[model samples]
Target chain A: MKKHNFNSGPSILPQEVLQQASEAVLDFNGIGLSILEIGHRTSWFVEVINEARALVKELMQLGEDYDVLFLQGGATTQFMQVPLNLLDKDAAAAYCVNGIWGDKAVKEAKIFGNVNVVSSTKDKNHSYIQKDFSVPSDNVYLHYTSNNTVEGTQWHTTPNTNLPLIADMSSDIFSRPVDFSKHSLIYAGAQKNAGAAGVTIVVVKKDILGKTNRNISPIMDYRKHIEADALLNTPPVFAVYVSILTLRWIKKEGGLVEMEKRAKERADLLYSTLDSLPVFAPIVAKKDRSLMNATFTTHNKELENLFLEECKQQGMIGVKGHRSVGGLRVSMYNAMPISSVQALVDLMIDFNRRNG
Target chain B: MKKHNFNSGPSILPQEVLQQASEAVLDFNGIGLSILEIGHRTSWFVEVINEARALVKELMQLGEDYDVLFLQGGATTQFMQVPLNLLDKDAAAAYCVNGIWGDKAVKEAKIFGNVNVVSSTKDKNHSYIQKDFSVPSDNVYLHYTSNNTVEGTQWHTTPNTNLPLIADMSSDIFSRPVDFSKHSLIYAGAQKNAGAAGVTIVVVKKDILGKTNRNISPIMDYRKHIEADALLNTPPVFAVYVSILTLRWIKKEGGLVEMEKRAKERADLLYSTLDSLPVFAPIVAKKDRSLMNATFTTHNKELENLFLEECKQQGMIGVKGHRSVGGLRVSMYNAMPISSVQALVDLMIDFNRRNG
Candidate 1:
């Protein structure tokens, strides 16, 4: 049986990327040393990071003003770093809390500076992208999650904001083409669509940093990382190498344009199947549905375990929803094949036939 | 020709460990999905982290009061975090500045609290560990780098102090058996003696936390990571897995005792050769020489380039000196075999004979 991996983050990656990554561990570029043993300052790894950074810019269509950084610590670390580097002690940053990640971001931001909760969907159990929000008059930036993995909601378009925008694109980045130039800073944990777990990719406009008056630690400071060319300290070498392989795969497979096509096809196929079945119900507002993760449940709650048991029997890994939200979740990242989604739909339909 | 890699820090790893790490990237534990795609919260990864943590305690001969965490970012992040967690704004921490890393650590520590420069070898260009100093009664902790990779100086004995000791054993952590209970906290970048580059091993005593009246960010707080069991966020999954593999190799090869024995053999072989040849001069005080790194240069300044050229021809990699202070440094971390050090010794003798 073909296994369909639907892990939310630290999610699926291309097969070729995994292959190359594994080989590099044994012998990196035939340099007679494992990539693990290679020095970060060596030309071999310098080229690896350089190419990875270049590919990110090329794929995002960003200009020279933007600098790409591969830093350690995940997007969770960025939640505080964003405000620490960009938000001053007296300033307030506008935030839209649509899901778990958004709520966490708000909490972290509040510790660093003033946070204005412009919009929140927690009232509705975060099943919709809260679009109605008034940005504060003196906001430093309007921060929002571009895609909510746990909530199964995504902003179809960029938020309408003139302030320097900060987006946590951890789950849904690189799945579609957006005018990436509009945002002052964009951060994503490489575990999702970007690459592997461990490293984080930050695309930031250089001028937005150093504006805050507070003393930020060197590792937490974005300007320090930018000045060091992301080599401020020993970076996550293997993680960055894997990211390079992933970026190369993305470019070779026709960039974000092709990725969007695949994402839409997978989401559409699964959502349509849920709608067709009378026994199944899809969660989240249809207008705000995520093309990356589709959340759904059966009307009879007791059948959830049986449905999951069937999923397990067929070699579907990590299809269970997050513990906080108990339901089935089918995550379809850029690397997820349509066949994987179709397999889940088949399991769901067969489950309905037996249980309904 | 077989390659002898002596890259400091992100240096060599066991061949068997590298093989296992490479295999896991393809299919982890014979599971259908790549290790890169596995969720951090899964039982598989949880088991891995648990075992790795347990191994750190067991190897160090520490008790339950100590907690181990595999963190992202390198030892650099720990420099500021050590003070942020332990040092209050009104308090002071004692520091020993021996080399580049120690100087950086002091600079970061001063940001959070007053730093008492109890000892320093900077006057002597950091060639020897300045042991003669007094620990202030008002100091919170005594901090020092157990081994300085750049200056090739190491503390032959742990610094004498009643203050809670904090050591950055980044380069030479697993190479010797220390009285681990002496230090309240120990942090090492996993690139050297632990496993890979991305993860950092932090063995911290549980009771030392919560002393500071600071609102530390959840990610930077050691207590928070201990509470979360090192899964505070999506950890560098692949990096931790590599660490586990390396730990397993260390345990199988007789743990720290065997590691120390091999380290002594390599260091003695290289130092004796350097002492025998007048053309090749070893740096650092005779007693202060590092068992993990041997720093030296030819007496003739003009022959330095020629010696490096001959080293390269003999397939010696990363034998070049630190860019800041020029001279060759051969770092023989736990993973470096005795054979590799002998090869370098042979090459040095050949160069000396030709140049003499």
Candidate 2:
């Protein structure tokens, strides 16, 4: 069966990336050994880590002032680590609660220090990004989620804040070019658009570290990982290797500019199809819609089930919406082809014509 | 050139496991979608998680009293999490500092609450496990590493202590059958005998959770992950999948009992070869040699270099000693074939004959 994957993440990856990753798992870089078997300290493995770090810096256009680290535990770990390393015991941190991920970040930060929720759209069930938020000058840093996977909302513009800005770009990283200098720290779990799960990429402005009074563990401290070159402990070797391959794929596919163009096109096609269909309506405000995860709903439950069933039959996988807000969600990450979106659109049209 | 992987970890896996993993990465279970692209929340993925968890329980003969979780951030994260989740603010934890890893666990525990070093081999450069360790009666738990990877030492018997027991079995997990009921919690990074890097398998007694007075973030809270069945966040999806395949490999190759027998045979072969060679001397105390990693050294730097060069020429890799303790380390994990061990022995004998 011809398959089209629309998983939010661990979503689709380029075929070339998959092929190269497979070869490396068997024998990395013609070293005649599985990537999983190599020592993290070995020149070969170190080069892999170095290249992956370099690629992140190059792709993001992060300056030398920024430290790139590939750490483990996912973005959730970062949620705690950010405060553990940055938030002083007596200080407070500002968070903009845009969606589920944002809420998680706020909850985690609160464990370390006082958290000020600058803005929130939870009353409306996070249907749109809340704007006109005021940043607390007393807080050490401002935190926000770049794109909400569950609510399908994105910050179309950067927040105006003087406090060191920290962004969780797990779902939307590398989808487009952003001013890397604006944020003091940016973290993204690799499962979404970068590569696979297990590795968390953190880009940190070196100045933001060492200011907090908390006694941070080496693994939790971004400065520690940066100093050790992300080899503070044994890293997630294969995950980082695939992330490097994925980054290489991104570079070959024309970097952020081309990625942004394709991402916009894919989301537009799917959203346009949703708009044309009476059976479906997008959940997020159009102006605040996520280019990565396109969420929609049908008023009739029976019709929604039918659409899902038909899509599955056509080998369209992972289109089912999150249980928190049930309907349908098509996550069009960088690797998801436009042809797949077209197939999904055709299925929706055919299903609507037959069952509407 | 044929490569022999002796990396302490992200170590060698069975070639068959690698082949199967590679196939899945390209097209998982004939689903026409890369395993890398599958949604973690899907029923299919849930089945994998469930089966992996079930397999761990079955292998360890763990009952409903235990909760098995596949977590991220390796055992390093657990160093802090174990204390944060179980140690009350007023309680102190007892730690037997056997080696580098055990020392690290103690350091991480101190971040959360009072930590008492009940005993340590650090005075002697951690060349042996301290068997006469005393645990404070008031301590929350007694933490130890089952085997010291760098020092090539293994605890032949569990410590008798009144407190709850926690073991970091990163280097020795699944090498032999263990009494799972003996400890309150057992955590191992999957890179050793389990599978690859990125995931940590944690088996905890359910009753130990929610007792700490400190606020535990979702990522650090074992209870949160256990309640969510280890799907609290997007796990290292591919790493977990590989671990499942490894468990299957273990089962097919005769469970832990057979694994123990094979591991002993390999270790004995390598150690005996070292003993017979006057040019090389085993590093660890003879009474406490590790069945997973065998460490040895030659006083003659020139001869040691020649030996290592010859081993590499004969397809032995990752034998270089740890920087902290310079010597040769031959890690013979469960996936290593007896033939490979025999091959290394042959090389060692040949080198000794020429050098001695």
Q: Which regions of candidate 1 deviate over 4 angstroms? A: none
Candidate 2 residue A105 Cα shift, in angstroms, is: 1.1
Local distance difference test, each candidate: 0.90, 0.88
lDDT by residue (tens digit), candidate 1, B1-356: 34788889698899999889888888998888788989999898999999999998989999999999999889999998899899999999999999999889998988898999889998888999988899988899999999999999999898888889999999988888999899999999999999999999999998889988888887788998988888888899999999988888898999999999999999999999999987898898999999988889887668988888887888888888888888988989888888989888888888788887
TM-score of each: 0.99, 0.98
- Model 2 scores a TM of 0.98
Superposed Cα deviation of residue A61, candidate 1 (Å): 0.4
Top candidate, metric TM-score: 1
* Model 2 steric clash total: 1
lDDT score at residue B229, model 2, on the 0-100 scale: 81
- lDDT (Cα, tens digit) per residue for candidate 1, span A232-298: 9999999999999999999999999999999999998999999989878889999999999888888
For model 1, the interface Cα RMSD in angstroms equals 1.3
Q: How many backbone clashes does candidate 1 have?
A: 0
